[model samples]
Target chain A: AQSVTQLDSQVPVFEEAPVELRCNYSSSVSVYLFWYVQYPNQGLQLLLKYLSGSTLVKGINGFEAEFNKSQTSFHLRKPSVHISDTAEYFCAVSPRGSNYKLTFGKGTLLTVNP
Target chain B: NAGVTQTPKFRILKIGQSMTLQCAQDMNHNYMYWYRQDPGMGLKLIYYSVGAGITDKGEVPNGYNVSRSTTEDFPLRLELAAPSQTSVYFCASSYSLDPDREDTDTQYFGPGTRLTVL
Candidate 1:
């Protein structure tokens, strides 16, 4: 079984400020990590993913994340925030060969203040 | 491609009532899934289908059932609705599930269906 933990429940930040959403996972086998964003009253959109290769993965909307295997962490860091960036972020994990079952974290509500 | 689409943007169900949540995708994805989103809680998979006529249960599949009759549609059925069944339901699809395929890492989601059970 795999599980994910998002450190903060809500993160409020000012526009143009940098922000980071911490995520940690636990699994006995290799896993794939993903970050998804959900706007109010909408479904989730894939922000990025870490399947393999480089530890640093860049995604859409000027978002990037670093995969630290030793720490079992995949924290999403965005250089600057915008009012439109306000949304709920979810971190998920799918163990290798698990038939695509994703274990998601509670989620971090990112509120970008104007 | 219209991606994934779910019907009945919002719904309210009385206790013991039964309803089917419709999900369709134009992307022709081989994998389709049903998930529920609760406040402060992340998504929990209820059921998934690898292809037409092939369905499987996920973590929270007790109260729900699913059917995939075609590559484009996967509907979720609730036999007996209860208060706990109230949540935002999302339908997602992926082109493939082959680990070797890069697209397998991402899933496209629908607008979602908000269901309230009372």
Candidate 2:
């Protein structure tokens, strides 16, 4: 079984400021990682994923994440944020042997204020 | 392409009532999943189907049942609705189950259905 843990429950940042959402996972074998964003009253949308290759993965909306194998962390970062970027972000993981079925973190709320 | 569609955007059920959430996808994906999002919680997989006539339980499968009779449709049934079942339900589809598939880790989600049990 695989599990994800989002360290922060909420993060508030001023518009145009950088933000980072921390995520950690627990897995005994290889894993796939992903980040998803959800707007109010809407479904989730893929932000990015790290399967293999480059440790730095870029995503939509000027977001990016780095996969640190030693730490078992895949934290999402945005150089600059906008009001529209305020939403709930989720980190998920799936074990190598299992199907694409994912295990998601509790979620972090990013509130970008003007 | 109407990637994924879920019917009854909002629903309210009384205690002990039963209902089924309908889901359909047009992407011709072979893998379909049902997930629930609670307040302040990320989506939790309720059930998943690799293909027609095949289904498996997920992390939170209690009080819920699912059936995938065809590749295009997968429905989740909630029996004896309870307050714990109140949450936003989302349907997602992917092209394959193989972790390394070309479209792996890419899941298209539906608009979501808000269900409240009182």
Question: Best by DockQ, which number?
Answer: 1
For residues A6-37, write the lDDT of model 1, one tens digit per residue: 99999999999999999999999998899999
Off by over 4 Å in 2: A97-99, B97-102
lDDT of 1 at A106: 98
Candidate 2 pairs with clashing backbones: none
For model 1 the local lDDT of residue B54 reads 97
- Give candidate 1's chain B TM-score: 0.93
lDDT of 2 by residue, B7-87 (tens): 999999999999999999998888899999988777888999989999999889999999999999999999999999999
Per-model RMSD to reference: 1.4, 1.6
* Candidate 1 vs. true structure, TM-score: 0.95
**What would you estimate as the lDDT of candidate 1?**
0.91
The 10 consecutive residues of candidate 2 chain B with the worst lDDT sum are B96-105
> DockQ of each candidate's interface versus the true one?
0.67, 0.63
